[model samples]
Target: MAQRSPLDLPEGDPFGPDNLPYGVFTTSDAPHLRKIGVRYGAHVLDAGAAAATAASPHAELLGASSLNPLMAAGRPVWQAVRAELRDWLTNPAHRHAIEPLMHPLTTLALHLPIEVADYVDFFASEHHASNAGKIFRPDGDALTPNWKHMPIGYHGRAGTVLVSGSPIVRPHGQRLPPAEAPASPAPASAAPTPAAPSPSASSAPPRPVFGPSLRLDFEAEVAFVVGAPSPLNTPLPLAGFHDHVFGVCLLNDWSARDIQSWEYRPLGPFLGKSFATSLAAWITPLDALAAARTAPPARDVPPLPYLDDAAAEPGGFDLRIEVAVNGHTVSRPPFSAMYWTAAQQLAHLTVNGASLRTGDVFASGTVSGPRPDELGCLLELTWGGRDPLHLPHGTRTFLEDGDEVTLTAWAPGPDGVRIGMGEVTGHVVPAAS
Candidate 1:
């Protein structure tokens, strides 16, 4: 595995022989069918097909359309298959038999790799959290009272989880009307903008208006796919993060800011967040990302005993996450700036005696850094819409219709090697009336 092998992958390509990220793909020739495939440079090895002809017992797991069955088998099976694939692709003795199973990746279609059992999103980046507080709650502390003590998160709608190329429908919902609007509203032709505010304004609260969201936004995030399930009343310690987390992928947690602000007073987000989420196709195993591991930023407040393990394992990834809207690069947020680690989030998710099922997805919320240019979402970058973001083609206070947002990431693989986490991209369409 160390030296260059028989595979024709470019030396510097992220998906080289040493990095065989797995995904579910199908060629145009067999559009209706999907088979498990492992990437090797520009090609995808039909693992299921290779296993069948190679007389490997793991063929059934490798050949399956989805990775769920293999995930449930736990770590040993995952390690074994990875080793086998590496050997089969590199060994001279096996190349002749494995060549026919490899297909150019460009000719295939990638689909959702697993059935999402649950989805949790965490506000783990201190920079992002601080900016959110300053922008959304100017009078309150940047970090909440309980924020440092726990990894704050909310359960997102798992059913709305979509694959990479899915279309994002701009959500329609209720927003508070201006406090200065007259008691009697004029017709659309008569008046489009709200009437000029009188010197003396009403003390009453504004009424709610229903329509498409005016403040649609995107959050660039990194999500991990849980590989195995944990029993009820049991918790996974910090040390078991990589053990239970099979792999990582790019995630775009789409949001409707106006709708979310109106509804998230007592309880957390519901429709504003539940509409849709996008994920990348490939799940690059955590094992393949050994070179990316690094020590996370020093914590300002130590967490409780259950979630704290300073001497444990490396907790941060050196991944560079970039956000693109309509082919314009908006930000390059730093994932390593996160104040909380994936281990902590996993521990807190199950600390309440909740069970974790295979395919559970959890994301490290918007990975904004300390710099203004490092902001991860429009809410932060635009400073709650007070300042508009200047783009190459145009300006955006928030996302406009036809805006295509994409999130992509890369991390240090093995020494000088780099691995691609793939991209989760979606185009925004006008909201349905």
Candidate 2:
């Protein structure tokens, strides 16, 4: 009896022919050389070598060490390459030629697929926003006044975006001191307590002390990668979303909450958010997620003409996400529950004539649902530390130095199959002295 081929994936395999997510990898023999790889079951297909062996015209694009060259070739090229790849894997005649190019996943070292040009993270989940407001500002309204009108986002540090499996060094910054407790009243029978020293007029305002962050957190998010570049002063409309976006990847925007609270006053996030961001190695193309598309939640407030997506195709993806800490499943947040769609976020991002560049990443911030167990971040899960999450190992309010956080998701595929979005994971380490 002949052994079964690796390409003959068993039924229900998430990385089947239908889900050929792309990545960059290096083999052990030649560690310095990187090649574009496609995930097929438990193996990584050497896409560049396969393209060359088939005498394909897109060989140069596939041969590049990074995905930027292929991505910048635009949608038509992207579609053509994807179709060709599917044919190569499915056609029996090419099996012998392709089988030799496949390598076991364990033997490859994966790297960040794209050269990140810019990054923008948005506050798009109503449930997450509401929970955060209730925890931090109990006396104020849960939702911000402008949240319903448009997607609120901030520019992030592109240089710090990291590949999955990278160690996260705890960041250091200023944090406000814990509030002082009032002195106990003296008993009437005892000597009166000496008068407490009063603050002088020249006393400086409360100074923030510097140290390692006490509130380290992880945000489970889904991000889209841009494929084509737009000219300066040209805004990408909502309809052009598919034309520019190449695919989606899981992202962990590691945050220092205490630092954020101290410095995010009038100017928004600075050192708190700029430290590091982790991204999955694989990128599932948008074309493969056709079955996952669904209508976004109905809007309470109508959007402006440019941002309006009422008549457009369904923009929300029905991806189900699971977050795990130390291998224990902690939360299952649904991506479909997001109030704002990625299309709307992209439109709003470029509404002011900002151009779209290839490799730009925009993430849907902290996907949380309406249930207690569906919260996305520790800030919400622990409710500002008033509540603690109990696990087999111990209880946790925020991340510790050795904790590992992993995020994984799957979207509905054709004929009841599931499309897996490979995980983004990071292990925390002590702050550098």
Candidate 3:
């Protein structure tokens, strides 16, 4: 693919590597759902207004132009908008017509690009899985028998997913009793050594009660947006998985380890994970990312034949993902550590003939690694806070109020400019009374 020239970058360069993700934003001058546009560098391509002035028939659809309505229209409309926008941004003649609507990218705040119907999280990273497993079940086994066979995942609360900048409330829930509340001192002994009280009679502090948790934490992962829809009985093949994917974004899956440990026994994560998940404001289209696609490292134990694609399509992305807390960089690694590919994740979702919706979402669970610093969540990072992480901000075992967490990603391609996924940021909030 040809890279965008630096000259083109000055005038809202849509092809710039850092601004690859497609998003919808509006200016204060024309504010309404009917007025929306895609961004590039310093420009905002007003799709709805431009199409209206040009007397284009599709102008009506573009009219109710925010991403919410566009997304409701499904894959057909998404492609239509992308195709038209691509031509206008890339051509000189259309550039003049669209330039009038260009607004500073820094001026607008982002809204949830799509109306999510359901959200699912997957254990896609091998390093993360192994690291997490070692924390959960240390000794020998790193994976459950079913893990190597398929992409394991759980359904998440779609309503809890929020856009960037939303304040994360401190979650209130049950916690283990604080280390026996420093057992009461025994009565002064008459002699050097006195008889000890009976174990049962020896009163100890009452067991801890259900209340707000103090051990709150954050989880960093990648999320993919579903553009197309598949019927309930349909089965999507691994070889053709990309057809269903619309784009990708950075996600922060917030967690309350104490609540999880107590509730996630037979069933998977519930209130612990269902509270809040933050996503970047913009959505990076799959087409814009074509140049950054690459194959992942070979799998160990050889995946089952049903899950194997044998390199039919790119199984990995060149994107370099990073995570930070309170302005401190945590992970500066690549996305290649994922054991299962997105195609496999989607294929597994539909193997049972389950239906998928256009606004559905899936998160790659805790993209941790061998090193302690590379761990995605505090649970594994601090070994349950038996050890606390010393950060530039200060020492922390888990997130505290006013703590800010941010996620950034970029891919350096043969094309001179780098393509980047913006960022998602949020600060912890005190629990509601």
lDDT of each: 0.82, 0.88, 0.70
Between candidates 1 and 2, which one is better according to lDDT?
2
Q: Over all chains combined, what TM-score does candidate 2 have?
A: 0.94
TM-score of 1: 0.92
Best by lDDT: 2
Over 1-433, each residue of candidate 2 has an lDDT whose tens digit, in order, gives 9978878999999998889999999999999999999999999999999999999999999999999999999999999999999999989999999999999999999999999999999988989888776655566677767778888888999999999999999999988766521111111000112233456899655568899998899999999999998888888888999999999989998888777776665567778888999999999999999999999888889988988899999999999999999999999999999999999999998989899889999999889999988988888888877788999889998899999999999999999999999899999999999
| True-structure RMSD, every candidate | 6.3, 7.3, 8.4
Tens-place lDDT digits, model 1, residues 48-134:
988888788799998888999898889999999998899889888988888778888788899998989999998888888777766
**Candidate topping TM-score:** 2
TM-score per candidate, in order? 0.92, 0.94, 0.85
lDDT of 2: 0.88
What lDDT tens digits, residue by residue, belong to model 3 across residues 279-329?
877788766677777886677767766678785777777777778888889
1 against 2, candidate with superior TM-score: 2
- Candidate 1 minimal-lDDT segment of 10 residues: 183-192
